[model samples]
Target: MECSDARMLLVVLMIVVAGSRQASCNVVQFIFGDSLSDVGNNMYLTRSLARPSLPWYGIDFGNGLPNGRFSNGRTVADIIGDKIGLPRPLAFLDPSLNEDIILESGVNYASGGGGILNETGGLFLQRFSLYKQIELFRGTQELIRNKIGAEATDKFFQQSFYIVALGSNDFINNYLLPVYRDSWKYSDDGFNEYLMMTLEQQLKLLHGLGARRLIVFGLGPMGCIPLQRVLTSSGDCQEKTNNLAINFNKAAEKLLQDLSGNLPNTSFRFGDAYDMVNDVISNPDKYGFDNSDSPCCTIGRIRPSLTCIPVSRLCKDRSKYVFWDEYHPSDRANELIADEIIRKLGLSQLNTTNSFSQSTAPSPAPFS
Candidate 1:
């Protein structure tokens, strides 16, 4: 062979290898939500009322200590990430969160008091709203671009998965509080429209930022939570509050369907946490639990404050309780919910034993 021909072929082979290297994308999870998925971002906020730092918070987590999760152990996000064999994304506000960590496993921007709307958790004094979390993510994107260049960064987000579980606070904290103007400003359906409108915009922004594979978790039966139940004179689930949740969930389901159809190269799925948890709470015996109306770690005397403080009452067996606190699911309950979410993400039939394969991710076709 001629010397010029040999040199030209060698150069072409090197270019091909470089191009492939830049295009490679490893699947990871970018989580966003409130307390249900909070891995302790609120801890950094000095005055955040919703920080879960008590001893009972993480008794079931690894090493039996607080790892920033609001529940007794892992949150739904943690369980799903583990089931998929993905690394746990560090809390966005964590001191250890850096460029290397962002590249290794994305970030969890979930704050305990966070919500879909910026004004949702205003009474909390400090929390990252959905918009704020997205803003932080944009900063992370810049850092990633500086480290790996824009092309590779774009591919990274395109291939990665996103889990956004929020909006409950918009009702439970803001509108229901009566302290916020949202309560008096809008009626039930009006509030629903307001939330859906804000959420649609946030989701579109995320897609524009390169997110393609994503799931938005619907609210659970918020009224059935111990906090709301304790508020009632009858100690029963507030059916009115539950109805509000149902309506919002329906709107979210339709919004996702439309977004999926309209948005190009996007697979938007709705994780029906409302129906899933309602089934468990309605029939605790089916899930090896005796009581679904109470929280295991709360000061369970049926008061408004259902927090699991250091001096609060404790249940005999945490496993038998579905709720870890007034507002969050127990570790075991989270496990069940995570499995449900996995199924919703088009992973029900696949062999999860192999760890989820991003390459095979499917669109959010209506579940059978």
Candidate 2:
């Protein structure tokens, strides 16, 4: 299908589903993941070099002040929150923040450079691992229970969406790092299996913690990012990395299937970010982008070596570029990705025949 047609269909699907739902049920969002979904959590960390609270980081974001997002503007979490009629959740670590209102609205526990595995982004000692994020959520749970009691808190979680966008850092910063010896321990498939298993365990923990509506975002085309492009002699996509991502996406699909079947009264949706992003990279013009291989802000070969600093030359039009820096997607790209996610969620909701009835359990459609 044409990209525009697909996007339109998705919008229609979302409208249908939203209209069918109870108007009184306020949708809250609890987000977790790495830089892609992080809304300034890293800035609160003293040891993180992944901080984006500097000039040029939020140049495209109105007001031209960095809000700690690693992109030129809003991340996927912010856009998705807006789509679901929720304000962007405040970062869990941000001090001087209003904890009561923010926690009730929901909290973004994503930390830039974080991953599923505790050791994934070890270079950044301060990054909150998925485990740590979950622990923090436990605290939030306690607060919710204290305010509204356990029964209301359980219903609150059941009505909320738990969004997780992770795994890229595991491959990019851990397995693929020169210093890491993960290569010696397992083949690509083996490593992916281990990662998926760990992810499943985390999801189970979330399930136990009262999450009923889960949205797990798959990894994107990591090989096509500027960092990987500059590492290649021909500046082409790193096919090995791409294959690994594809394999992991497939594994994630199965994991979601298993989780849905085993975790009663729960809904699971997998967002195929790999396919969505690969399409943009393959046909940048179709997405109104002029550059996909090069970053909008960079220095020295446009790779992660020099990194995007204040002194680096910034692109005049960030919307023309797919990537804002060596790794993260620009706000434009993130908007597209977020649209795809909303579409996927809508599709899942539409396919499930009796989504609102507690007595009926609808089998979710498989990941596309």
- For residues 1-368, what per-residue lDDT tens digits would candidate 1 score against the true structure? 99999999999999998766555444767998998889989878999888888877777765566778888778887777776767678999899888877876789999988899999888788999999999998998998899779888988888888989998899999989988999999999999999999999999999999889888888888889998888888988999899999999899999999999999998899888678789899999998988899887766464556357767776878788898788888888888888887886655321223333342221211112
How many backbone clashes are present in model 2? 0
Tens digit of per-residue lDDT, candidate 2, span 1-368 = 99999999999999877544422255667899998888789988977878887777776665667878888778887776665556457788877555355444678899988999988888877798999999999898887778666876777777777898899999998898877777567788889988998999999999999899888998889999988888889999999999988998999988998899989998877888678799999999998989999988877553564247866777767778899889998888988998898886683331122222331111212112
Alpha-carbon RMSD, each predicted model: 6.4, 12.8
Q: Candidate 1's error at 209, in angstroms?
A: 0.6
Instruction: Judge candidate 1 against the unseen true structure and give its global Cα lDDT, from 0 to 1.
Output: 0.83
Best by TM-score: 1
TM-scores for the candidates:
0.88, 0.85
